[model samples]
Target: MMTTQGGLQPTSNEANMCTNDNGSQLGTRIVDEIMAGKNVFFDLPDKLTGEIWTLKFHCIGAQPGKEIVTVNIDKAYVAFYNVVYIKSKLGYSGRDFLFYKKRCGIDRSRLLALDYIHQEEAMLSDNMDERKISFVLTKDPPSDLEVSITPIKRPRQRTNVDEETIEVSIDAYKEWLAILQHDNPETDLMDDFREDTIKTYKEWLRHQGDLPDILLYERMKNKPEDVDIVEWHYMVLYFGSEKFQKISSRNSENRQKQRTKHIMGYRTFSQISFQQRDPETGIEPTDLSLWMITHCKNDEWSEEASRGIYENAAEKIAEKIYQTEKFYLTREEENAIFQTTFKETTGCKANRLHGHGYLSRYPTRSQVMESKFLEQARATVATNQKNIELESQVQLLNEKLACEVAERERILQEKMQALQEEEEKKDKCLEKK
Candidate 1:
């Protein structure tokens, strides 16, 4: 037995399998073994307990065995374990491994069987370190293991050219929108696109003080790389319009009325839904449960307050579930129950439902009228202020012009007087002579 670092002891047979050859030779040997229909196994050291863990790779295909071996190994390591750990375990440096992989012609893809095996092993090992693999692979993967391979969809590569400098025509913007709509017909491309552009516009708007319409429109320099120049220009103009300004302002006030601020950063509701599963049976949680899990974070809402709100919501959800003889509530029912429960408990309605329901309450007739009146009043005041400034500028210009005209008249008068005096002197001199 040869004892490696991290207290990992490989048996004589396992020790003889991995030679002190360079990466190129080792890669050649690995390919030759796969071609001979033999499984390759690597002894790796567990980071936590320093135990020897065996990783086995078997090529299933009879013909083109090299492709199968290279592809599967590449996928397994790239998905579950770091490529560097595998390189080091094989006694090869990073640069050497890169050249080795290139020489082997490995193509990376999803490995569902490997992923399933990794998940099972990780659960048994209780290792949360995703950067390192701590579990052992079986000599043969389970017969019942899921082997469905899904191709990873890569996003369209964007040009490195600066977005602001890229001049996009209206036709190009339309063509891009058409392509996007054609590709994703199910998606509300325009609405989603508008929302993102509006968000960018809001960020720019926040920094700008009171500016004239022309200046506000002219100062839209921060264009998102995804947004075409023409589209961004049109969006900026629309967002800066008086109508949209009123809408944005109203939305801002509504947002301010929200009580619960979710602490989930960069995590989608779907991702959070996975965490809300029942530990025993793996049954997915209802929408209500998901909302509570996402919102009841101690950092954003106090533990006491969160607990109180959660308990109240849970009680209400439980009663509903009991009455309906159902384990889960539909999204609509869940939203209504949550809204009612939150209002009952807190004595106030939630402004934004975090995309769970309608964002704001339907304004009453009186409220709508009042909002309209306020908007109009603001617009009138702004118009009056703008007109006053323009009038002041015109008056100043007129005054300067009047001063110039008066100075010219005075100079002309002075010149005439001098000429008259000179002529009179000439006449006197002629008469004396």
Candidate 2:
């Protein structure tokens, strides 16, 4: 529709019908009619059924969320093929568009529908959607004329591909990633994914007194890094379709090691010389492994000392794994190995809380079993004594060898001097002759 900003008063659409397929006069709104006594009319071009038509209007000082003037024009007049343009009479802001017929007009029932359209021209306004449009009429009625036209493209044919193939559930992926990321705030992410995380997890599991699932839950919740991807794959593939379940050790080398370590404080039963048998059938092997005993001593153990103990234990467990011991352990189990295994293996300053009797399978069984503390102390003293005596013998041998070499040098020098004297005597005899 044609819009004028200054001078001249234009008549209503009834007085001046827009005969030209091209709109000859300014557009109309009911609010405009009441306020400015101007008429707005909708005109369709002749011989145009499928032809695309566009509606253009001018808005004056219209805010975004606020409603501009509304008018009841023929719904048919409102009909056109494609685009709508809105012009502002205040100043030449730019190009603008009105609400599409397919959106707000036809979809009042739909919850997700566009309520209004923004005029592209108004975008130039500092506030854009915040400003309104103002228009003036012409004294001659037809100040300017123009027809808004828009081209329409035909829709393409549909294909039969499945919806699932085209769409991915980002929500589900986000949840999975969240689970993977959940971890101890204090623990570094790099360490969690590293090999050490799994070791720490295993140790936690061994010492934890909670139910298997509960234990797993707490461990995973506290330290997500401890969960190895390989372990997850193994659990899912071999165990069938399940979340997580405790596996029995009867058929598992790992469980056996766990049991051996539990009772004897070593991951390798070979070192401890212990065996687990089936509890159901007296002679057969049992499915369950025995739980190892662990104690926390407050008086003798500070955090620093315990840390060293834990680290040494971890290193020792790493050593065993490096040696290709025929067993597997969870990360936490390995950590437990560091603590329990190191104590039993090293038998150093940190001994068990209560002096327990040694098992028959213990390597130092007879010696340890006979007089636990006294025997260990004597063995340590004897070892030190032997080391000192061997060093003294070596020193004495070195000194004796040095003295023998000096004596041999002295005798050789005397022999040489005697030979020189004989030579000098022969020379004297020659001179006399």
Candidate 3:
């Protein structure tokens, strides 16, 4: 395989063969070798098709221009190949590959550096004489070229001949959490263990309310196979706790209070903001405009309940912008103005109204409509206050329930003790008779 500007280009000889033959095994081995700082050279046959490919990492050192460029380009090449191989195994292609790369910590900067190194190597190879160009092989290679390739391990299949154990790091735990929580369907690439763990957690959550304390405690104690015991304990304890329940309930309520929801699925706020750029000015939409555009239906504010509040906030923002002689505000200034306007209009912080708070900074309209908007805003504030009070009451009830449960357990223990004493007294009477 030759490295090209676009990416790895397969030679004519290897064109017919699939890159994913025994990919899991090869990827695992490559990752292990790279982490261990060992030179990897292997000729392995594709498990499915019996096509053979040579995987070698050459640590080449050359003085390109004024600087000494020491890099294992072959290592990067192999790692890149493994990334492709893993992606193929997971059925990820096109734009989804970019997400996978980011998830694996392979950023554009690293890729650019790799490409630059490759370019330098090409220039040196072409300019210098074949005999004079010293090919110095070193055991220690540049750490930058080492990409962290997480091979997707399949269930019921051995990763290696020795069945070497793969340790799940804290980073993996975070990645799993992100993958599970992310709303995108494309991000649902989880190995068997991760999938199982998530399913287990969901099942536990579903029954958390109905299950007794003893049953719930037992479920927490019963750790899944191949799961990190410590992490499992933490996950069960934290997520099952009353504190997390309260937070989740509050977030759900906040989401319910939102007047406008965007139809743009899987696209992030940054992506939407970038896409909302003006064609002529090339300037991105203001935070308020962006929020309004996303939330609006048919390019018009649709929700009658909150429409007045949005219109009033927008007018206030425009007034502030017009007051400035420069007729321009820095992004920070714009954001601050939006937040202040929202607070002044809504009688609550932007964060309190909008769950994430970013959308709360901007309103969509240009003109202030009616005093009725202020009335609506006041009503909204009152509703939010009531919700808070209700949440507090719920928390108190939960605490009271917990105390009652504990008291019941103590009473049950006392009753059991009394029964044991009565049994002992009956046995003494029988012996005396």
Residues 388-419, candidate 2, lDDT per residue (tens digit)?
Answer: 99999999998999999998899999999999
Q: In each prediction, how many residue pairs overlap at the backbone (N, C-alpha, C within less than 3 A)?
A: 0, 30, 1
What candidate 2 gets wrong by more than 4 Å, as runs, is 1-372, 395-399
The alpha-carbon deviation from the true structure for residue 165 of candidate 2, after best TM-score superposition, in angstroms, is 81
Error of 2 at 254 (Å): 16
lDDT of 3 by residue, 349-383 (tens): 43532412344333435422333365457668777
Better model by TM-score: candidate 2 vs candidate 3: 3
Any idea what lDDT model 2 has?
0.38
Q: Estimate every model's Cα lDDT from 0 to 1.
A: 0.51, 0.38, 0.49
The pairs that clash in candidate 3 are 288-362
Model 3 bad stretches (over 4 Å): 1-234, 253-267, 278-282, 300-302, 316-337, 350-433
TM-scores of all candidate predictions against the true structure:
0.28, 0.19, 0.27
